[model samples]
Target: MNDAIHSSKAPEPVGLYPHARRVGNLLFLSGVGPRQRGSRDIPGVTLNAQGEIVDYDIATQCRSVFDNVRNILEECGSSWERLVDVTVFLTNMKADFKTYNAIYADYFRDNQPARTTVEVLSLPTPIAIELKCIATID
Candidate 1:
């Protein structure tokens, strides 16, 4: 594995994992939450009963998550278009999938990277979504 890369513009990692790790030309990004910059805790407004944030009315949270992802990707000399695969984890699979896809479509408008989305029992803080991606740099 190549040295891990981090982004100051993104939220500080809450656990032992680095923000992202690069090996050769491939970057493996840890699952990213919707925590805003400089805040260790996720914004409490949009979450559901299962601790997953409600993504329906909140475009900002979605944007923040993508921004965090972009920051990490850029730190490793890549971008959203370079993403080859993504796995999205959500607390409520049924309600939020469409909204998530609508917002996500704005980001991956062109490349349409391979992706999988799963609804899990729970997450770190009941946040709405967590995303992990594999990307190629150059």
Candidate 2:
């Protein structure tokens, strides 16, 4: 059976969904963005009052997204080292991949979870990066 999980320490989801779900020994996380909890502010992103992203810094967005993912992982009694797989979304592959990869390496340096990075037209939020992952709780 699977059960949903939420974290007070992480950014609330933009849609109707929990931050993570547990089934057996694995926890699956929803797409975690760079938005801050309560404030809903997206780091590394400069948005117009209309909520359109005018500019962004990939490294900053990547770090914030990772922190959100970490919060969900820790809440599930897991950690970075426990991550088994991850799917990353980026708005600008040509411009952002280099910085994003370098910052990502700093987080999963030793753990080395299987990862796939894809260029998406856009994310649900104005942020430039997001990550959804699965980790073994065992």
Candidate 3:
């Protein structure tokens, strides 16, 4: 059986989908972004009048994305240590990868889950980064 999960403390998803879904012991998270809970504000990001990204601090976005992922995992009965895999999406890998990787090391030092980071032209929102994750819940 599959169970859809929502997190009140985490940012609402940009689209019409649950934050995560549980199939038996495995939990699959939707692509999680750095938007803060209850608002569209993205940390370290500046949007122009047209809502296009003006500038962004990848390090800040990386931390916020990590925190958002963790909140969803904890809300859905999993945790950072329980994560089995992560897929990262960045709008600018060349400019952000080194900073993102350094911060990622800080967060995943003890529990390093399998990870893949990629560059994308854009995301649904003006945010610079997002994360998709899989974890086991006991």
Q: List per-candidate RMSD values in Å.
A: 3.2, 0.9, 0.7
Candidate achieving the largest TM-score: 3
- Cα RMSD for candidate 3? 0.7
Clashing pairs in 2: none
Cα lDDT tens digits, model 2, 1-138, are 699998999987889999999999999999999889998578888888898988888888888889889888998899988999999998889999999989988998899999999999988888778888999996
lDDT of each: 0.79, 0.89, 0.92
Model 1 clash pairs are: 46-54, 47-53, 51-126, 53-127, 53-128
Per-model TM-score on C-alpha atoms: 0.85, 0.97, 0.98
TM-score of 2: 0.97
lDDT of 1 by residue, 20-115 (tens): 888988999988987877754465445566755554343555777888888888877899889999999877778778888899998889988899
lDDT tens string, model 3, 1-138? 699999997888878999999999999999999989978779999999999888899989899999999999998989999999999999999999999999999999999999999999999999889999999998
Error of 1 at 35 (Å): 0.4
Candidate 2 deviant stretches above 4 angstroms = none
